[model samples]
Target: MAAPIDRPGARWGVAMCHGFSGSPSSVAPWAKGLAARGFDVEVPRLPGHGTDWRDLEGRRWREWTECFEEACARVAARNDVVFLAGLSMGGAIALRTASRLPVAGVAVVNPGLGFYDWRVRYIGAIRHFLRTTAPIDEPAAPEPVGDEGDYPVTPLAAVYELRQLFRATDRALPKVTAPLLAFKSDADPVVPPSSMTRILRRVASDDVEFVPLHESPHVATRDREALLIVARTAEFFERCAAKAAHPAVGA
Candidate 1:
């Protein structure tokens, strides 16, 4: 992944976190944009990602969280102000980190807490059917933006662990002090709108802002509104920058 931020004189550093079963390559455009805006960017490749699908068979949530925590530590060390941006599962990791770190701000895109309902339990059956008799349109699109195909079949054990992460982070939500910019899609096939609402309502900081992507699907980072995502994200971060530069004067 690129070093979190790259503007020669930029003071704040940004860490770009990718979703579960996704690699930094998928978040490249956002990282590049952040870099263009003078933020050092680091898109860390989570454990079990960017490798053969089977390599994820033995991996656990701890492996992925640790990788991001390490990246945050590295970025935090080099810059005076550090920010975070993540997609899907990466968003959860960003929240988890924000709860513990002195992060300046965070931007979350379609952060996945978990599947919506019990039917999620049937994912294995669905995967089997798709692999055997049916072929779903490759979850990652082709040509326009191809799926590198490094992710593994969803592991029940890992899913269970991710649930634990959600609960833990939910409890920590009210404690995070950083500013937040959360984005969710109206047509998302994966995440529910309620989850995004919950995050916005629970965070202790009143600096949280939510933007609904009306036309995109779950992966709004790669969806049609991607430019809007990038533009709005930069605008939000810039607002935070201005806040830091000019704190309110005493009455």
Candidate 2:
């Protein structure tokens, strides 16, 4: 584990998790920008990601969370202050970690709270049909970025695990202590607006803030407003750290 510093000194560390079936490259640019602004960013490649899709097929949610936890430990050991950030399923992992760990705060990009559409509601049925009937090797364009048109066909088991993670994180929201900065793209076709509203309304901490990306899609981390998201997040965490260092007088 990286040593946690009492103060950030010249740098504050951040552990960034990529979405399911996605690689660190997806969020590397965002991390780079944060690092340029004096943040020690650690973007871990999720288990079975960045490799063949089947390599990740047999893996479960624990593998993904454990990988992130290990990375967070390393960053926490080295930096006095650390923030957890993620995209999609990775956002849920960030929330889960902050809910239990002693971290500065969290920045969730398009957090997967719950599916509102019927097609998504019955995703498992489609997954089964695809899994047993026809496996799609052609990757769909990565939303928000649209750089990659190919993605590993999601494994049914892994999707199920993600569903469990979503449920578990929803249950744990009221226990989260870290301040949160959550972003959602109004045009996002993947994550529903209800999920973002629920986080804003139900999360235990009052230090939560929401940013609605006007025209962005699901992957706001890589959208046109990506840089703004990163800047705003860094600013928010910096304020949290400042408040922690020097509290306001009178309760």
Query: Which candidate number maximizes TM-score?
Result: 2
Clashing pairs in 1: 3-41, 4-40, 4-41, 4-42, 5-40, 5-41, 6-40
Candidate 2, residues 22-126, lDDT tens digits: the string is 788667657877776677899888887877777776787888889999999999888877899998778988998888788878998988878654554565667
Q: How many steric overlaps are in each model, in order?
A: 7, 10
CA lDDT of each prediction against the hidden true structure: 0.74, 0.76
Give one digit per residue, the lDDT tens place, for model 1 in 53-126.
45554577778888998999888888777888999888988998899888878999988776676654664455
Pairs of residues at least 3 apart in sequence or in different chains that clash in candidate 2:
2-74, 2-77, 2-78, 3-77, 3-78, 4-77, 5-79, 5-80, 139-150, 139-151
Best by lDDT: 2
Q: Which runs of model 1 end up more than 4 angstroms from their true locations?
A: 1-10, 119-143, 146-152, 249-251
Worst 10 residues of 2 by lDDT: 132-141
Q: What number of backbone clashes does candidate 2 have, counting pairs of residues 3 or more apart or in separate chains? A: 10
